[model samples]
Target: MNPSITGFDYQRVTVAEDVALNVAVGGSGSPIVLLHGFPQTHLMWRHVAADLAADHTVICPDLRGYGASDKPAGTVPDAYAKRTMAADIVALARELGHDRFALAGHDRGALVAIRAGLDHPGAVTHLASLDVLPTLDMWDVLHGVTAAVGFHLFLMAQPPGLPEELIGAAPDAFFGHFLDIWTRDPEAIPAEVRAAYLRACREAVPSIVADYRASAGVDVAHDRADRAAGNQLRMPVTVLQQDWGAALGFDAAGIWRAWAPDLEHRTVSCGHFMAEEAPAETVKALRDLLAR
Candidate 1:
């Protein structure tokens, strides 16, 4: 545990087969698990987690392939599927003795949270997604010049070796692009923290690519199946998005409502990285979700 970041007790725990996660736990109330996005670790929730910890027992862990978590080789295209990743969260919470808990995720993690709520509706008490739409909706909505904004999504969706090779060749520049572009305030992330995120991403290229590849493939199938089966998030869900649909050409809240029956969707001013860019609003949203 680094003393520089106070309030949380950090430890590494093996949560699955050959998967050990670096988890941070703090405060003393109901458990609220926070899942991080791509090119980022649990550290992305540093501010929000600390604030939530004051009233709720906050649990933040790097998703399977990112941060200090175990990066097992040969993760199949289906392995990075959101369903499997969501199961990991359930197992981690169970391992830590929480049978039911509030769940929140950002970006890639938000996709995982959606899967968890749908697959194991009984486990997740409340759900919060920051700055993302369902995988299928995201792909469906992309077209023309506006689609260029997420060029990396299409690039990283390619087959294993080539995409990994290209990204690995210049990892810092690749990861730094998002770190620099995704935030409304780049200064929100200190140099040391930014470098740390880039370094972690650089070392976990294969797993990271596999994660995105799943979204392009198996994850879409999973979402389609859920929709076919009339599955929706049973828990109360709160979504904070950047109003991409208005800027693009769809209804952001409308699309989210298709997946979540009980939804409270808000479009905020922050960039893609809302948790970091708008900590106070993010914290307040989480608190409201917890209350629901």
Candidate 2:
């Protein structure tokens, strides 16, 4: 953790079916839960979580199957469903006395947050997604060479055995590749922090792959059903994404508008890991969104 980011007391709690999560809690005001994306943990939000903790009761949790959280033994399809993971977040918040709270997630965590917003709109006061589209939109928008950039999405989405085996065989390389590639300023993440992330991913390979696999299969079904039922995130929503569309070929705002009616969307120059890559900008966007 960075010395500059302080004031949080870290604790471990179990939510939903004995799933243990490591959470950092601090500050006081409206509750705000932060979720980390793939190849990272609650540590990814170390900088941003500390900032939010200054005004809000910030709760940053390592999503189930990642970080210090318990990785329950299960198959890829069963272990990584966003529905199940979203339940863990809801249960965690409720356990911590927050029936309704603001929620934000980056990368994989963003996908789970989206599910939580869609499935439990009454419980999410506000929602912010960092650098990701809904799983369905992601698959729907992929094209020729543009999609190649996210090859891991397809590879990890494969059935249990092969994907897990390959990742497990070379865990450091697999996880380190993203850590190295996703940041414009790699030195921003200290050696200890980078090692921690790599270790977590190395140990939780099956569950991680299952998560992506579920996004490709069952998770998409859930999102489509929510859309078919005319469900839009009723809460004020904000999205910060790298300019994938401009760089690739789709409209980022246009796609998000389809799901959130009251959305404030922006494109930043940072890489996929916006929170760490652009903490000041991320903090500003978060403050502005929560204020609205």
Candidate 3:
């Protein structure tokens, strides 16, 4: 059986036609939806969700084309676009009877949450992103040797068949590479959870690639349009990220401030998988965001 968030009730909430998200929801009070990043499932939020559940109604869901969620064919660019994924999240919350709620995400999920905050500002009461730049700025800052770190982004962004075939050929190596490197503390993700992440990624290669591919193309276009329109995340926004600025040669918080006016940008000392490696700090930051 698949590992799930402990103390949370699991269900399939229909977010869109032919796309129902696998969600684990718990606790009660004001609602907050937590989204997981790449190469993992809602289970990535297991630790943070449990703590947040003590007071807030925490909802954790596998984004479309991820985990146990419905994987509609990514036959078109828009299929896996962050916009569509964000819509799925908004609908998921509505189905669970929440019209407005605090939203947070890590990595890929952070991309979705950013899109949601831009597209559905009225519905996303508070917004927080963990360890990722917005799509447009992400592409803008990556240059020269610094871009080497994002090799997977370029590989997966290829037209279609080739990237899928290449990754599918060695799914474990491709996905496990991130799982191993991005994490600081191996024990943070016990063997079972690591196994679960690998299993899910191995099974969802095409959709996962599609998700990244969209980020390279349509997602960038959407972010560009939003920036051009002077659209920004109006809600209280908190960003928790490693101090990639010093190494990557860009002010991470400065870039985030361009998109979020009311922003609290923080740099974490932990690894990329901050939620897992430092759940206490993650929870504290989230609680602070909610309080604002």
Candidate 4:
């Protein structure tokens, strides 16, 4: 099938020996980096990137373990930690001639953006995270039957061998479950896009598992250290989510307030794939963040 973003240039930039990200670059103005979530790639930014290109230089990259990026060996634990992934993003922006940029990420990418904001506050002028609580808050909020909604988190959090092996056996079904359930608009994700996601995920099963493994262990530890240090995101921050707080009986804004001092947290009536399902709203929210 034809590509998602027409006329966009693609490059594989090396971040580390075993890591290089496939990046799509378009437009020509203040740089804005859009990171995709799990089981997907830079293609997720198709609608938003094209629109943003009218006013901003849009950089959409497949993160370290997904899409066309390097899926390094999973033997070493914590290799896929968000801290490490965030560093890759920083290096990516530097390679693209942008030392600092506005950043937005969804799902797994949101976690990476969160870490990036905390670890390299100077590099991110404005930060936006869609559909996630901070790592510690995520674990804290999740309990009882509500936690069942995040069965995948617990499954992937297990030790290296089992998670990877079980997922590898039926990678498509395992990953496709999220794509099917999380989005409200079943038609928002085209058949071609769905196939592409499954294909990328199936091929990168080991690295994908390693990525989630880091979240349960190293990513959480990194978040804790940041909390202990009382370091908050220095840049302007905006969060758009599906109001999991209302459903789970916790104040989403309250939890985010602890991390983002300069905050604009709001709930959007959209699916997890807001960028694809509601691009205009997503872009409007992001434009507001950029203006901030």
- What is the TM-score (0 to 1) of candidate 3? 0.99
Question: Which candidate wins on TM-score?
Answer: 3
Local distance difference test, each candidate: 0.88, 0.87, 0.94, 0.90
Error of 4 at 24 (Å): 0.4
TM-score of 2: 0.96
lDDT of 2 at 116: 93
Alpha-carbon RMSD to native, per candidate: 1.4, 1.8, 0.6, 1.1
The window of 10 residues in a row where model 2 has the poorest summed lDDT is 1-10
Cα error, candidate 1, residue 69 (Å): 0.5
- Residue 51, model 4, lDDT: 94
**Candidate 1: worst-modelled 10 consecutive residues by lDDT:** 1-10
Would you give me the overall lDDT of model 2? 0.87
Candidate that scores best on lDDT = 3
Worst lDDT window (10 residues) for model 3?
242-251
Clashes of each: 0, 0, 0, 0
lDDT of 3 by residue, 1-292 (tens): 8888889999999988889999999999999999999989999998899999999999999999999999999998899999999999999999999999999999999999999999999999999999999999999999999999999999998988999899899888989899889888988989899889999998999899999999999999999899899999999999999978779999998898999999999999988999999999999999999999
Clashes of 3: 0
Runs off by more than 4 Å, candidate 1: 1-4
Write the residue-wise lDDT of candidate 2 on 1-292 in tens digits: 4232367887788886667888888899999999999899888888898788878999998888888788876653546689889889999899889999999999999999999998899899989999999988999888888888899999987767899998899999999999888888887788988888888898889878877888889998998898899888889999999877788888989999999999999889878888888989999988998899
lDDT of 4 by residue, 39-95 (tens): 788898999999999989999999988988887886776578898899999999999
